[model samples]
Target: MTTFDDRENAFENKFARDEEFQFKVTARRNKLVGLWAAEKMGLTPEEADAYAKSVVQADFEEAGDEDVIRKLLGDITSAGVETDDAAIRAALDAKLVEARRQFIEEA
Candidate 1:
């Protein structure tokens, strides 16, 4: 292949890898947030895991984090747990940091 073709291929590969990494990070963050919410709602260990998976799946409902955030907020309130949007957003941020750290370590 020509140098130009090689460069294009490399860029495409990098983009793909970056997208995959982001997906993993988001999924991990969702799971972490789900676990935190679960604990707040007094869920058992098994229930927490299931809830986390559901949170992960909830992300597929939309293109951004809003869907996941909405799901968590609704679930938390529905469970009669006391929490605000700001707290949930803070948790989401914290979990994203943790998820990125874990992902980097795994790499």
Candidate 2:
């Protein structure tokens, strides 16, 4: 193969790897955030696990984090838990950091 072709292939591979890494990180963050919210809502252990999975699936509803945030916020309020958007957003940020750290450690 030509040098240019080889370089193009390498770039494509790198892009794929990066996309996969991002997907993992986002899913991890969603799970962490879901657990946190579940605890705040006082869900049972089994319920929390299912809730976390649902939170991870929420991301698929849209192209960005808004869908997950909306789901958590709505659920929290509907469950009569006392929380605001600021707190949820803060949790999301913290969980993202934790998720990235965990993923790096695992790698």
Candidate 3:
């Protein structure tokens, strides 16, 4: 293949890898955040695991993190937890950092 074609292919591969990496990181973050919320809601260990999976699934509902945030907000409130959007957003940010750290450690 021509040099230009090879460079294009390399870029495409890099883009795909980056997208996959981001997806994994976001999913991990969602799971972590879900567990955190579950603890706040006073869920049992088994229930927390299922709730975390549900939080990851919630992300697939929309293009952004709003879906997960909405689910957490609704559930936490329904469970009688006093929380706000800012708190949830902060948890997301913190868990994202933790997720990235876990990935780095694994690597």
Number of the predicted model whose lDDT against the real structure is largest:
3
As for candidate 3, its clashing pairs are none
Winning candidate number (TM-score): 3
List the global CA lDDT of all models.
0.95, 0.97, 0.99
Ranking 1 against 2 by lDDT, winner: 2
TM-score of each: 0.96, 0.96, 0.98
lDDT of 3 by residue, 22-42 (tens): 999999999999999999999
Error of 3 at 103 (Å): 0.8
Residue 40, candidate 3: Cα error in Å is: 0.3
Which stretches of model 1 miss by more than 4 angstroms?
none
lDDT of 1 at 73: 95
TM-score of 1: 0.96
lDDT of 1 at 53: 98
The 10-residue segment with the lowest total lDDT in model 3: 1-10
